[model samples]
Target: MERKLAAILAADIAGYSALMEVDEAGTFQRVRAGHQELLEPEIQKHNGRIFKLMGDGLLAEFGSVVDAVECAAALQRGMAERNAIGSESNPLQIRIGINFGEVIVEGEDRYGEGVNIAARLQALADPGGICVSGKVGKEVGSKLAFAFEPMGDQRLKNITEPIACYRVNFDRGSPDRVEPHLRNGYPTHKKTSIAVLPFSNMSGDPEQEYFSDGITEDIITDLSKISNLHVVARNTTFTYKGRPVKVQQVAQELGVTFLLEGSVRKVGARVRVTGQLVDGRDGSHLWAERYDRELTDIFAIQDEIAHAIIEQLKVRLLPDEKVAISATPTEDVEAYTYYLRGRQFLHMCSKSYMLLARRMFAKASEIDPDYARAHAGIALCDSVLHSWRYADVSIETILATSAKALELDPDLADAHAARGLGLQYGGQREQAAAEFKLALALDPDLHEANYFFARFFFEEGDFERAAELFEKATQVRSDDYRSAVLLTCVYLALGRRADMKRAGLLGLERAERELTLHPENSSPAQLGALALAYLGERDRAKEWAARTLAIDPDDLNAMYNIACAYLHMGEHEPALDLLEKVIPIASVHRFWWSTDPDLDPIRNHPRYKRLVERTTLASP
Candidate 1:
């Protein structure tokens, strides 16, 4: 035990679980052989010490940051070369993270934040790649042949300061690889299609954005009720909220026949709302209107606009759809305001945001006891937080709140969607399906209904239906990160590798963008990592996977994704082992064990078969 400043190198096998499942004894021997013959020698060559073994990882110390960085790169290259001839049963890959700082030594043990930082960074490394803190990167920057990608300031758990990280670009010297095309050949509708961009807030106050956004969302929701008219989802159109784009460009980007542009100016008790429906083909205004109304008649104004759009688009809606469109969300303006604020927080989807949303919804409920949409908002927030492991709310709470919403307004689609999720997770599959179908029937444009129903199809092993619905969800909301990621999973299960990669890349892009704004949420990072693996960007994949693990080590959904990452990398044994870790926590995940195309390569393995059986027996 002693204390001194030093450089620490942390390394661990990538997909170790999947590798072991492919050939436990052989994989163990291979790792052991590499350690004894390759790893040990390489460390000694750089004058480093392998002082500790933590599970399937190694912790080493070097006097110089230069030595540690060099040793890490060489070890990575050597492992990649060794894996060149490796088979499915025995592929060898490792991720390394390095940091330079003072270490505390006690007897033969070394411990400190420096070591912790190195280990965390190691998790960020891709198979056959290295990650280092800013200090290590600066010290070795001028010397290494590899280029480093600055990963921005990563907020690591238990670390006081955000660490500036760099990922060693493993593909820098590798042969060129072609990336597949991302666009699907989706046909344009012969009928009317429209995208309603978020209404501009001319309220002159930026804080009034929520009101403008609420109007835009309600219009989109109402328009979506028209079965024959194709409408882009609110999430997709909101991406253009403040952007000044031409009508033609908006139409082309959304692939719609028309564009709905508008502005809302709320001044005191009176409000001014203006809207125009522009023909996509010629960028000509087909219809235009302005509504000057008191705050109490906001619902009437919304209904009038929705009706005018339908008339101009020349789409005939059935009695039910028409009724759905005109259904008032809330009669109380104050309650509606609270609901809008709650919605703003709900979409942020983090623990803190969810708490804020809960408060807002509670206020709305207190203000108007019969506000079904407000109650539904509360239920939806709690359910999502629970599902994402962002909160400890019970299924009972979700069920109770959703039921109260339905009791207040039976046809409220969001309430039904929330109830469906509650029932689905509560093991009432058939009842859940019924609820989802009813929800969609009430509001076909409801994002959650489409997403959750598509998920049902996916788990039912109906990949074709799942893909269709997931694609529908994306069509409804192009910026829907969850839909994009789940669609990637569906594509993988269909053995459509190109589609899988394309969907994954798009999902990862959107997820990363959202993560910048909501870094505390782990689902985006966890899901983004799986998407990266699908797209074969191993370096970034490892980085995101490590980030997710760092946020919440016991996040079963995230841990389940690590299993998918191993499979995407083609490490069968280690992928299975990762599943073993996930099964105890989320046994229902085993539903896809035999059917998931991602795990098809290892389904024949005896270990996988037994593990699936174990999980199945433990699940119920």
Candidate 2:
């Protein structure tokens, strides 16, 4: 072997084996396509030579460290774009590490401490990030205009001195660029973000849709109980209803770190459910299983599913979360079926459906008044009715109903969530926060609680906490289009430019997809407008905004978002003009104006100040 000084590049799929197992042919095709189309071209463009390809990993050598580092960044950005539409079970993500050191080069491969160190550094990189050893950093420091964050010192497997590392922050041509902070030259930690897609209904009878949906809801509820995990809520998950979606797109739209998908089938007295846990970073299946059981053992089946997931994810179930699962309303199959039906209607989020849900919950409660879950269902329905202002019911009546449900069973997280929403709407901010906290304590997997907490944090001007909670909510339910869109706003508030761009692009893709899938829906059009605005596409943003207003003139969020778009584009006069029209409706409804970070650009403007003062006086 000939020893040579080189800039060694090491690259690997974050979760290769598991992804291949999930869909060997598909994963192989996508990964190979990415390697040939993007990675190879990038390396060549930067004057780097591919030394070898070892299964899902590769080694390359470059004469210049700057070129090697730049190539890694470009490759990752392209891969992320490609993976946006691929299957989550085999996502096209690679971790790249660069080091400047001596390597023993053979005919077609390289080896030595330099190669090993680069490989190890790849392991330390985030899914779409680059990690460079100190040697590489020092060599490129004066030559390139790249920002580096020191990760301190890392102890490699066989290296003597601690290897200092630096993370390259992706620069997309903005003066106010944000660099990723690192501890010891490596990303210190990663949040556990997950998206739980809707479970497929495979039962021969179409009427069993409710049963299958209930199973998905239960799994989501159970998973949200893990405080360490960010579970997307049912509202978000159900957005993918009746449409085929690739797992990678699901992960990107939801901004999740992981993905959970499953199918449910019921046959007469027997039910069968299959579930698989996947790593979103590279579409790897961490665990998969099928459960077969009788319909009479519905609660037991739910418990088994929850336990399997907990074990697979290695999440520690808190004592209270464990106890909540076992606290079922006896083994009454009829009552459980009624409760499931109620839950299905409740998830529909329509007034008529919720009324039907209330009747089903009443029947379940009548069958067993001591059923805490049934009471929780009633509480949820009442809260929804109150929120929608159905039949002009008093707020007091809604709160009372929610309180009764909680009184019947203090451990019912759903009841606490309902009460929290009711209290918050009734202007009891402190009590609402406390109730939300209690619900979270009772069931950490409660998506509603997490979502409300995110909103609370945003309203309190705590953008960092809001972003964290929003991220968690997305993880619990990956298909939630609203949360996915809202997260872009959170990223903007936190000044995470790369994250903002990634999220904005993901939201735009999802919104466009949704529009194509459901052409008549106005929401997606509005979301597309917001995304376009964030991306600095002023004309396109205005066009989409106009389309949204044409569909629904009274959409305050859309109206406000349009105003924000103008503000971001530096069209202050038009922005103020739109804001003047929006302030009245926002004040009347107290609709998220104070918490909207998009309005930051116009916050100090004289027009904004006058509008706020006028709205405050006009508000009741």
Each candidate's clash count: 18, 21
The reply for model 1, stretches above 4 Å from the true place, is 1-195, 201-210, 220-243, 248-260, 264-327, 344-360, 382-397, 550-556, 570-585, 592-620
Candidate number of the best TM-score = 1
What value of lDDT does candidate 2 attain over all alpha carbons? 0.71
Q: How accurate is candidate 1 locally (lDDT)?
A: 0.76
lDDT tens digits, residues 118-137, model 1? Answer: 98787666567788887776
Cα lDDT, model 1, residue 495 = 76
Candidate 2 stretches with Cα past 4 Å from truth are 1-199, 203-210, 216-263, 266-391, 509-524, 543-585, 588-611, 618-620
lDDT of 1 at 323: 83
